[model samples]
Target: MADPHERNGENERKPDSTDDANLSARLKSLDARISQASAQRAEAEPRPRSKTDSSAIGQAFRYSAEFVSGVIAGGIVGWLVDRLFGISPWGLIICLILGFCAGMLNLLRASGTIKPARYDDKK
Candidate 1:
């Protein structure tokens, strides 16, 4: 039985020294070109802003926190009033309404829709 590679002379072929040198030169050229391209791209691109710059997501989170904190504070105060005055539902309900108003007011002020009370006090 004859081997197929032997019949085709595939196993007898060897890489030449010149072929190795040529391949090495091509690889170096490719690496240099790649590095040059990367440098140019870095120079062309704009630098990112610093962390102190507030993004849209940060502003949204701040606004939501302001509104939520107001609501939560109102709920706590209402609960306390109910507990202290021995009123079962009225105190809680009234306080909850007030809390919702406070939350809305806070949101308005934060959004610049309504001015701060201090502005009026100055006048």
Candidate 2:
């Protein structure tokens, strides 16, 4: 008598439900692990969500530094001028005011409130 699963000399392979179920379970487990890793990585490395936020913070620091440096440099130069030329308070006052204006202009440029002359001229 011939076996029901045999066709000529070759044996036919019958599909197993358990094999399909195991493969599906393994695939689902891999997907879960990948999702968990991605979540962990995201949590571990927090980043600025927007370019504007990062640049704004940088600009704030830069403007503050520029303003302070201008004031200090002006004070030093004014003091030097007064000592060398014997003009006293007037030299310090005028130079300090000029420095303040220069600082304000720098801040405006940094904030994009004013257009750059050189850049505008180039266009």
Candidate 3:
């Protein structure tokens, strides 16, 4: 005679093909939604700008500040060094020259007179 538990187990078993098809359809739907979300995110993100993006007026103001600060700092240092070392006129004269050079250097750097180094593809 057939056992009652064996008969119940056969009745409870579900078809494997239906489960596989359902899972495949759910996965495909999820993949499509992910692709759409990614595209939207890309469109919402901001693009990077170049370093030399300032207007002419802004550039001029920056250069002016750089030049003035460099000259004042250099001159003060030179004067202090001269006074501290007891070099009177000689210290003052040397410091003035150094200050002028520093001012010019600052102006050149601000105006991009010196070219930036180029990166090589090697390495």
**For candidate 1, which ten residues in a row score worst on lDDT?**
4-13
Which consecutive 10 residues in model 2 have the weakest lDDT in total? 48-57
- Of the pair 2 and 3, which is ahead by lDDT? 2
In what order do the candidates fall by lDDT, top score first? 2, 1, 3
TM-scores of all predicted structures: 0.52, 0.52, 0.47
- Cα-based lDDT for every prediction: 0.83, 0.84, 0.78
Residues 41-118, candidate 3: write the lDDT tens digits.
Answer: 999999755457467788788888877877777778878987899887787777777777877787887677874345
For model 3, the run of ten residues with the poorest summed lDDT:
114-123
Native-to-model Cα distance after best TM-score fit, residue 19 in candidate 1, in Å: 54
Residues 56-86, candidate 2: write the lDDT tens digits: 6786888898787888778888999999999
Model 1 gets an lDDT of 0.83
> Total clashing residue pairs per candidate?
0, 0, 0
CA RMSD of each candidate after superposition: 8.4, 13.0, 13.1
What shift in Å separates residue 113 of candidate 2 from its native position after superposition?
0.4
Q: Record all residue pairs in model 1 with backbone atoms less than 3 Å apart, i.e. clashing.
A: none
